[model samples]
Target: MKRILTAIVLIAIVVSLVLLGKLWMITLLAGAIAVLAALEYRTISAAMKSPVPMWWTIGAIALFFLAVFLRPQDTITAVVFSTLVLFAWNALATGVDRVLGETASGVLLLVYIAYPLTLLPQIWSLENGTALLLFLFLCVWCGDIAALYVGKNFGKRKLAPTLSPNKTWEGAIASVVAAVGFGMALIALGNWLSTNGSGYTRLHTSAPWWEYVLLAILLNIAAQFGDLLESALKRGAGVKDSGTLLPGHGGVLDRIDALLLAAPVLWFVWVVKEYFSLGSF
Candidate 1:
């Protein structure tokens, strides 16, 4: 019940934000989420006994996200520069015994959490972006639902016994199937919106159906990998949950783990499609 309620509230918040259809709103939302997730990550790091420099890590996260909106070129620079700073700080502060793990954890948080979140606003900046972002959410949502349903019912072969015992091969396949099905549903909705929505652009279907199927598989798998990755992080840190930020959801990191891996791929697909002038993503 708590999980269901949390899902509903989360969907409401996300849909409301997306309906606002403003890049700033998305950026702000993503920034807020990034900060919270970073703090949770800090908690996890501390649990592992490798604390990231709080101010430096948080400041770098904010800066990289800002680059997501202000200057695309600066985004890469921000990450590279932040990484160097983190490494140097670790070397100076923690000394040799803990420097390697500390530096690696700090840098990984930048790439793993901050970087992918930057894509949320980037996706919003593209043509038919609102729809694409919604579709991305839908894909992840449906994939998760399907994984849960199928895994609970038929999951026998352990996908990763140590990291996430609940996950299974059946769940993974179901996630892909569910994402593809959601893609087809999006195609239907796009056709409807194209006919009825004046000035409201929907994601175009210029590519063949197979292309979309492939994209769905990629996204679903990426999201699954993200879930597994987070599980690994928690397990490695010897913690069951990242934080209690969200009810029934372990933490902000737990909730957005799928997006961490999924967003970069989604952004990349949008970029490639735009670069080729291939219709709306």
Candidate 2:
């Protein structure tokens, strides 16, 4: 019950933000999430004996989101470069014994946690951005729910025993199926709205069905990997949940870990389709 309620509230908030279709608003929300996730990442890194500076990590993450919000084109190159420079300087200031571990963890905090999330607003700024954002959310959310139920009831063969003992191949397969099904349904609804002149112009109603299916598959795979990636991190850090920020969920990081990878995959596809004039997908 608690988990269901939390999921409902999160869905509502995300839908409201996407519907508003404002870049800054979405960036602001993403920024808050990034900060919280970074905080959790800091703790996890510390637990693994690779402690990164909390203030530096938070600052870099903030700058990453801000850069993406203000200048999407060169945000990654600029922010990541500056962040590395800071990490190098810090290494010089402190001792160099744990430099490799600390620096690597800092970089992971930026590239893994901060960079991919900045793509949310970028995805929103694309053509049919609102619909795209909602589609991404729906697919991931449906996959997560399906994986949970399927894994618990029918899971036998472990997917990755070292990283996450509970996950199973059965659950992973079900997640992909559920994500693709929900994605197609959403696309169908968009087609209906477009045909009926429902005033919902944020959807890409003309794309071929197969393209959307392929996208759903790609996103589902990415999301699954994202979940496994977080699980590996937690396992390495010797913790179960990332943090207790979200009741029945874990932490902001635990919740958005999938998006950490899934968002960038969508953004890359959007870029290729738009910038390269692919005209589809």
Tens-digit lDDT track of model 2 for 234-263: 988888898998879989999998888899
Error of 2 at 210 (Å): 0.9
State every prediction's TM-score relative to the real structure: 0.91, 0.94
Residue 89 lDDT in candidate 2: 67
Candidate 1: 10-residue stretch with minimal lDDT: 197-206
Largest TM-score belongs to which candidate? Answer: 2
The per-model lDDT (C-alpha) reads 0.84, 0.85
Off by over 4 Å in 1: 197-199, 202-206, 274-280
Residue-level lDDT of model 1, residues 1-281, one tens digit each, is: 99999999999999888867578888888888998999999989989988888898779988897887888777889888888888888778777889888888888888898888888887766766766777788778899999999999999999999999999999989998999999778866775677785644545445566777777888888999999999999999898988998888779998889989988998888778779987665
Q: What shift in Å separates residue 158 of candidate 1 from its native position after superposition?
A: 1.4
Deviation from native of the Cα of residue 215 in model 2, angstroms: 0.9
Q: Model 2: runs farther than 4 Å from truth?
A: none
Give the C-alpha miss distance for residue 79 in model 1, angstroms: 2.2
